[model samples]
Target: MNTNSTEYRLEGDGASIQSLPKISLHDHLDGGLRPQTLIELADEQGLEVPAADADGLAAWFTEQSNSGSLVEYLKTFDLTTAVMQTRAGLARIAREFVHDLAADGVIYGEIRWAPEQHLARGLTLDEAVEAVQEGLEQGADDVRHQGGGIRTGQLITAMRHADRGLEIAELAVRHRDRGVVGFDIAGAEAGFPASRHRTAFDYLASQFMPVTVHAGEADGLESIRSALFDGRALRLGHGVRIAEDLLIERQDDENTYVSLGPVAQWVRDREIALETSPSSNLQTGAITAWGDELVDHPFDLLYQLGFRVTVNTDNRLQSGTSLTRELALLSDAFGYDLDDLETFQLNAAAAAFLPLDDRDELAELIQDGFDEA
Candidate 1:
């Protein structure tokens, strides 16, 4: 791995988190741009950027996303999406995304983004997908040249408030044999639940497409219910609010008693992976019910209760973080050991929207990586 000591590291003494073979199941393609790349892309497109330099731009993204409201926080994506209106921009960013993940020792990753959002420069949905695919393949090559290996897939997302779910789902299935691996619906989660796009989900189901939904992040269990019932989401994007389903029964010297409501129970029984992004959850207030601190996050509770919790960096650039930094923060807050970290990686691998053979291969890779620790 690259010896950038300035890069993030875990707090544990066992091994560097950045060196472990991690898997990113819910990372956003638009949200993981390098600051300098953003500046150059914006300048080339004659678009306005908030900060004058890379450092300032990085700080600006983190600050903007730290706002409490999810809608307010989503405004940062407008900036990232601005310059990504062309094939070149998409390809370059995708290639660099793979390189960054490989540098952080992410052996497998699925980069999700809304194709409709990237069509502003007059490119069609297919064109946008093609550009991203080119970049993803190039990124794989780059990783090999750098003495590392990584496999990436694209998760095409439909904006929930928009009426293009069917189109995006079709687009996703159209490229299933290509780089696309799954489909999702993202956007405002309150009034526009997954139920609003039932036809799209139905169509994707008929096509046998794998799905993950961004639910319970900005909303509560009702939204999560819709994501489960309507969207048939196999995985939840930041389902941290499911903590609301837990009723603290009692606390003794030995352990704490908690009761899981039906929603939590169903999720646990179904073993639906919760794509929990610790830093982004804090910024978006997804874990506000527990508290504002990282330690206050119900990650430990959910983990202890046997929720298929997977650690992720939802937006690497906006959080100014990596998978390494995210795991480190969680460890520092919750006093997790290497075993906890390994479990998170294994959960992500099992929940990945890949073929059975590929999933098993990823599991093996993860086992080998963690065994080194």
Candidate 2:
């Protein structure tokens, strides 16, 4: 992404957004590499790159990802994952991912990626998870030695178009005690509903594992419904299209009457978190139903209706953004202040895959950080 930038602060009071404690729920491990690091890793593997230098590569990613199509945006990952086929490559990328998150003031993050995509390098599924864990530990240790603190966990993902959901779910459960915190299903959310992975979902439920399904992005409400009923998802990855269930009855100068359909009502009443990535949503045409601008996003609508809304950077490298930058964009779009930002972080903390005590600790930490700022 664009790494050369000044600090981001609130508009009026100039409160530093980068200094505030934040939590990341939807960040992808393969989607957050530094451009220079990608160049070096690709060179080591004799992989061909689209651009020669870091600046050129970063610009290429930005131009390619702005095509307003999820499939096109995903094509950029082929380059990133190609260089990540070896143990050393995976470890180095994951370690740098953590360091970058820490530098952006992320106190905790759940890094998601598909291990099945990495097995072309002769590593078993178990070995792939172990390599990522080793890197996460090393990154955390490096942060501690620098007088900073950061925590991270893995969210093992199964490609929705693939047929390894059951096996991937098993891998997540096997590593739950190590560093794996949750399970997820991603990729091509159109025809592949979560119901296709009913067997995996049943197994995960039997083991009492937490799940977050990518829905309401490329598809509509039925996809989200399947995620909830079939996949038993506790949170929705980029569940922005649940807005389709919202019915705006009438509008006037001062107030507008609105009604909620079953899906939106259930998500709101049950407090199922919506992991909304503003820029990624725009890039993928997820918000085209509403409009084509950041201010036109349904994020403010979801937040106003009291949905458990959390801000995220779905793919930092693809979107050319960070958690801090995402929050700033939202604040600028909706005129939100520090209290609004704090509420978003608190929502993410509540919806985290950690235990109740740990979630409470995170909430307190967030509140303390915002208060101090």
For each of the candidates, the C-alpha root-mean-square deviation to the true structure, in angstroms, is 1.7, 0.8
* Clashes (candidate 2): 0
How does residue 320 of candidate 2 score in lDDT?
88
After superposition, candidate 1 runs with Cα above 4 Å error = 1-12
Which digits, one per residue and each the tens of the lDDT, describe model 1 over residues 230-297? Answer: 99999999999999999999999989899999999999999999999999998988888789999999
- The true-versus-predicted C-alpha distance at residue 215 of model 2, in Å, is 0.1
The local lDDT score (0 to 100) that residue 339 gets in candidate 2 is 95
RMSD of 1: 1.7
Candidate 1 clashes: the total is 0
- What lDDT score belongs to each candidate, Candidate 1 first? 0.91, 0.94
